[model samples]
Target: MRRKSLSTGDLARYCQVTPATIVNWIRAGKLDVYTTPGGQYRMELPKFIAFLEDNEFPIPEELQADRTRKILIVDDEEEILDLLVEVVEGSDANYIVRSEKNGYDALIAIGDFKPDIVSIDLNMPKMDGAELVRRLRSNPETKNAKILIVTGMIPTSDLVRKVKRIGVDSFMQKPIDIDEYAKALDKLATFKV
Candidate 1:
């Protein structure tokens, strides 16, 4: 499927320019963008690709949409979701990372995302992580998915044991340690959807 959009930084990286340059382009009416309520800018993926082609700019190999893996991030905290998205998407893995703030949305997204890896929090609303994990394991489509638990909910020994019993592939605490996060993702990178 065609990726829907690109953040200013994503476009800037592909075009070999600073994100500020992309912002300037938008301000000068050189490039069109949609601004989120949070004031972040996003450009339609197809349109940006066309613009690059028209301008004779060489598109980065990764930007050509040769994504190898899809990652779904589930967390109830909006800030955590944003942070995780930024870290994972900003990496050079060329993985598609999508985030949902609730398990219900995450469940719906999982079908569409068909993710190779799912990094989730334990204490989510609508559906808790344990229930989500059970559902994923029970569903043939997602049973083989690599599940990583990332949460700040103060895990007790029981919680750890329970998650392991549910077949989580890995676990990390928040605020996430970047090295550990990268390591976990790297470990899961061998799996394909």
Candidate 2:
């Protein structure tokens, strides 16, 4: 299998440093890097991960290949939640899934799991999805979370506008297509700079 590679910018984000610092590290031989034909520096993912571990640097979620990506699903209907859990857990990609019946519990789970992506129902009871999204956006920890809203509720044009204002990454209708959902999850989890 071809090894994943990261650019200096990607490494900088993981290290919480500027790309210039990454360039300096490469110059100082502190980090291993290779040059493409076009002379862009690239670091092998495995080597970079090992380097971080050896130096006791905090590995960002984007670099945690060993850890299964966590996904949170929130829907008021037990059946829908179960179906989502089944689809995500049965996916080809490694993932750990948690399901909640309402946005309230989903919030608690978010704090606990720090899920990479959240698939939520807009019509959930007890703290609707809109309010939940607002709270997630307000908090620094989850402000950048990727959100996908799945709802059967026919949203009016205004409601769609409202959801856009809250900054959801994607939206899906209820009775979700398993294949489509899986593809979306793969994109979100394997995202690289």
Candidate 3:
């Protein structure tokens, strides 16, 4: 059966949260929402299910899918990369996670695997996160790639403004929280193809 998308109000009622909280989640890159040509927001069913599962919130049995979700992580630090993979693997058996040590390698992998979502580190030995995002955005094939920039650098207000201009899909702090990682992935999965 084909599931229907839900509006913010509908989702709030279903999740037992306020509409304002839903809006905040959307802004925080926790909830995935689609914008119509007229700029109205709606949530996709599969992504909503993923969000619920990631948060340990209850989900209707019928809403669960059999297939695994694919994810890619790009980072220079081996420890962090491994840790991210471990967390995702432990969270759900249905997640296929892969990692790359640098942005250049990650780009190459993306072309072949075509992951549902990607998490990238802002600093690396080769290409940095900002430049990687620019390149991805410029390319027709990867223009719609869902990218989350994870960084440890403490940025000034000016730097934050500049980072926002890069057009990254989301941003997270370093030493990633497991729940937050899952939430970001769930949100990215909600994006319309």
Top-TM-score candidate index: 2
Q: For each candidate, what TM-score against the reference?
A: 0.62, 0.67, 0.61
Query: How many clashes (backbone N, Cα, C below 3 Å) per candidate?
Result: 0, 0, 0
Q: How does each model score on lDDT?
A: 0.81, 0.83, 0.77
Among these predictions, the greatest lDDT belongs to 2
Tens digits of per-residue lDDT for model 2 on 1-193? 4348999998898898999999999999999999999999999887897687557676776456554677999999888788889999888787889889998999998988987789988887789888899999898778766788888867675666688798998888767898888888788776531
Instruction: Put down candidate 1 lDDT per residue, 75-102, tens digits, no spaces.
Output: 9888878888888988888788899988
**Candidate 3, residue 52: lDDT:** 75
How many pairs of residues in model 1 come into backbone collision? 0
Point out where model 2 deviates above 4 Å. 1-67, 155-157
lDDT value, residue 95 of candidate 3:
73
Per-residue C-alpha lDDT of model 3 across residues 1-193, encoded as one tens digit per residue: 5556888997798789999999999999999899978887899887886687557576654454544567889899999998888877877546788999998998899888766667888778788777777788787666666788788876554444566697878888877887898888777755544
Judged by TM-score relative to the true structure, which candidate is superior, 1 or 2?
2
